[model samples]
Target: MTFNITTKNLDTFKSAFIAALLAYIFVYGFELTHFTLSIDEEPLDNFLQTLSAGRWGHALLRHYVLPEPYAPFFTTALSIIILSLSAATSSIYIGLNKLQSISFVIMLAALPQLAYQLEFSNQADTVSLSFLLSVVALFMIEKMSVIRASAFIMLTVVSLSVYQSIFLYAATLTCIRITTDAIKGQIIFRQALKKIFVFSLLITLSLIINSFLAKWTALYFDVTISNYLTSMIGWGKRDVYEVLKSVLIFMRDYLTFKSAYGINAFPFVLLSLITIIILSIKRKRGAPLIILMGFATLLSGFLLNFAIGSGMPPRAMTQIPLVFAGLFAAALVISRVRYIGLIISIIFLCIGSAASNKLFYSDFMAREADQNLSNQIITTIYNNIPNFDEKVTPVFFYGSYSPLNSWKIPSADVFGSSFFDWDGGNNRRMYMYLSTANLIKLKEPNEIQVKNSIVAAKDMPSWPNRNSIKIFDGVVVVKLSDKLSPYNR
Candidate 1:
């Protein structure tokens, strides 16, 4: 009996894995096969650099998926496999039937947030591993004992150390689990609350331990923790209110198919929710509690944004897939229309795949445009300077490039934005691009030179103008725009 049970479990996992893998391939195949680089990934050509950001787990595991010779293809494949494993683990932990499992995995693959995470291809595998770890922690803590709780805490810390956003993923999973168990009568409402309380305590403990370890690791490595996330933390009333409002607006936009980074399955999601509600009313269960828990599970994805008192990028909203999956799963369980649910899942998968391909195409075009502009600038520098390579010509960019009219596609966060956009790191990004291309050896201007160049560039013409490229005091100053922001200056 044990052998048969183990074999059955393994087969279920395999089926879930295969379903997830196919769904992911259908949606993100273009990205996995192509070499695409986002702004943050530009500096991660041959090495992983998240250690300084206290992402020791990411830094350590990223070594295995580092894109060396094959560029992005290998890393993308590995990342997809890890993400499929996460889906499989989640399927088993949730105890979904085969059809429900397929629906869940399909929904997971169709997540727009997953696409955003893949944009940073170098870290994609590590992020996927972090997600898998979060699911595993949830699975281990199902029968919470002393040993299980300790293991769950350790796993939670490791997942958070890999990517801080995954805490939301794990928490969202807990919320979904509680709601499902309560609705299915597998656990009473009181037991569900107790489980939630225990899970919350463990998660909190894990967070504290992770925070301290991150600080200690940074200190030991003599590296400063990146303020990218920390700088956003605050309890200011106005900002807090704005973030809360934005969260609601984001949900509305997403559900209405108005959000740029939302899966095009709002109709399906709406239908599923309606079905769940109807079934709850028919069953005469605690409909109010189920509704409340369901909403909490959905909102849990954005809990980090509320805690930080700011908006987060789509990549940080990684639990979005889980939200939709849980909704669909609930509908599948309560409603007799299982085939309809499967059909809707297939439709969602198709739409998501189409969207992913569109995004990949847009990114490809953006990279091409960026490269062409860089090459044009390089050529102009060589032509104008004549002795460009003879001496150290420190390049100073006065303003940043905006692909407003240059590209036809609408920008979605960092998806279609130029690398040279006014993000306060345009100069460094440009330098990195040029260096990586091996087209030209350019020197970065010092702080004083950059300041002086900005002042001098005030009188210079913008790009496409003959006077835009000029040399002053052996520094090559390229003025991209006549208008300069305080950040660029």
Candidate 2:
């Protein structure tokens, strides 16, 4: 059987091809095959929690059915499929040229932090965000029949429930549509009001639905949903000044391209914004909406970052990158000199892609080095200390050194901490190291000490008796300070 080719079908094929190609580059460049669970990945607990609570089914499949170390590849591949659909629908809905769509794909593929999420961080958001994007694309492209509209609403609810960052995408798309209409003078006051009301109503409905579901789940589990709600709202009360500071820091990091490696995205960001403004003005239709788009873009990033609370470790700025990419694509499509815009966009995309690859490559290497160091230290302790296999192993590390670069890791955050932080054994971080190394079945420390100062009897290696070096009975003190090396010791 021969397949008929239409413009829409052709566009879909092109979008899928470009998206798949981009995903392949990202997977190979980031070394996606070498994935390992971080300290926070507790497969059994995650499975029980979601399966029992009745949440996103994809997340449940990821945690329960998929095998460790390679589960990420499956989930990531699923994300690529979703990304392809979203891209195809977006190109059709927005009337983007092939060049613009390719540029969008390149921009998307080069985001450095996204590599971190796909390769290292938990992918609950990956599936959630991908679903959200697909729904948004469908909503935009499809005719607004009652059945289609209802389907969009249902899909939106599920995506929102999985992760609230879906709000950023919703807000960004709505802003773009409204702004485009406003610029064309086609949006009436009543239509504008209706659009705002409908969007707000859908979101409010989703929130209520999520709340009831969460409440029911909490009740089943014999817990309160208030804490979960509170955590989502803010760790505590939102400090306006603190939130602003965080937004600024996020912008600086993204624009300046400041990473562990010195490569930055400032030039790309600057050029993208400049092209957006120029094209917007040249169109003369959407000039006013450009300001609104700018505001929406900033708000998108701020909201996404704020949702994460304390850590602005680059990965949290997920929606923002995609929004910027959308803006760049929009600019390319609308520019008076489309070819010129394409050239500049291509330059930026190439720069971003190279930087993205290098940044993730270095980070992955550093993480591996840290893991090796931790393994060696654990082996040494298991062999040397008497009763090491009998009692709980509590290690107090003061400093860290990466075997790869010999660069000093901060005392507060080290790669070795993942052995405890991510692995399923309590929040303490040491049990994971012991368990992964095929060490003894000694239990984790029972007491949760919030403050410093511990009194441990067993000492390993050249440990000091300083106050910083807290020791407890049946615990081993493992000094992470300099002059500490597996080979040297």
Candidate 3:
């Protein structure tokens, strides 16, 4: 007998292992992998900075997610909570047979676009999926009963309190229930209905509590902080196409194998095909519509972003791909296209996701500044400030998300808790520290109304590699063109 090992098979398996490792790394290093929001690492970072600044008041709203008129938790916080749950469930999937294990992992991975709601986009989304998948795996592995399936369905929807991913959870659960004839028996339906009802009630309560807490926090911080809000009064009525065009440009930043934004266009469509495949196998038809609606929900959310505001970036459509990628993987496994097909599916996801990481996150991970001008200016202040709490040091910026305030500057806000767009509060310290764009605007910002706001010694913009100061009444007013610089501009 002769045995041979092919490099191709080894290579495929090795790559798969490494790919999973990369995802694990990204889970923890998410903060360094994405551009995040302009103000900071999205609201979660701002909320944390608020907490660091002893401004817990604003931190609450900075972390939750919910329907309109009700903020549940900041995207970051939601991601964390959901991811944790999914990971815990993954542990449960372990020790199972290959078919069951793969099924669980595949289904858990193909979830809604709830992960990017925070720092580690895929992690939390995977986690939420794990919970739903766990129930399915349990049904497949243990004493399967209609009551257990129905109860699991209710818990999956109700306990999570995130409606965005609910469609996937609902569809997947219903499929298992009806097709397996586990929970679809009309007599059993009544029990499942009660469970769902109770779950819904609990979800509403959670949302209500979260909303109340977040609103209280923001309001409290608003009192002590003065923020400047640039009035784009006419921005509301500006041409939607222009904004859409601009948004598209920004999103383009994520494509080209440089980032993880494009490619969602096709996968989204593929989801429909996969949905059909899955439905055909299962005796359940209603479940597929539920899954399709899940995609629609994410699309509607993204579309709303474009219609109401300026244009959206094609990259913003990432959520579509992310969720569909999950669905695609599940469909592939369930499709039973031989083990060979399964291998190919994983390969595609690995390569595509890796390319995205490189494109959208390279600058962030590298911390490579586009220009030295912003650096020159911030460096000047940090180096020149004398005796800040016994050190000749200056803090670069202050925000609710920052760690420390600069004592070198008199009346310096320790955190940017108060920033632009406040009607009335205590953020005069921030407006004093202007961006290069604001420095050259000519019109004195009416927002700087605080009594003793620091005088910028260099209001002029400075470019990377060249630093000069233009001071009027001790306020720096010179302009250097380094807007392309990374970190802060």
What's the lDDT for all of these models? 0.75, 0.50, 0.34
lDDT of 1 by residue, 166-234 (tens): 878878877777666657767667876787788889989998999898888777767677877777765
Candidate 2 per-residue lDDT, tens place, 1-489, comes to 112347855875586457635643553344445444443442324533443333443343455564432355565565555655565554444444566566665555544445445444345335535444544634632345667666666666566555545555666656555544454455655665577677667666666775576556556656433343345443455687776676567566656645432225533555655766766677676565665564565456556556555434444445655666666665565553456655664565566566555544554555566467555765666555645654445554433332553432332122223342222223233444345435543454434421121222223323332332334554555544433222222
lDDT of 3 at 44: 24
Worst 10 residues of 1 by lDDT: 402-411
Give the 10-residue window scoring lowest on summed lDDT in candidate 3: 407-416
Q: Which pairs, if any, clash in model 2?
A: 39-422, 39-423, 40-422, 257-264, 420-429, 454-471, 455-471, 455-472, 456-471, 456-472
Best by TM-score: 1
Model 1 C-alpha lDDT versus the unseen true structure: 0.75
Residue range 323-406, candidate 3, lDDT tens digits: 343344334433444465445445444554453343334323222221232345455543543222212212222112221222
Q: For model 1, how many clashes?
A: 0
What's the best-to-worst order under TM-score?
1, 2, 3
| Candidates sorted by lDDT, best first | 1, 2, 3
Candidate 3 lDDT: 0.34
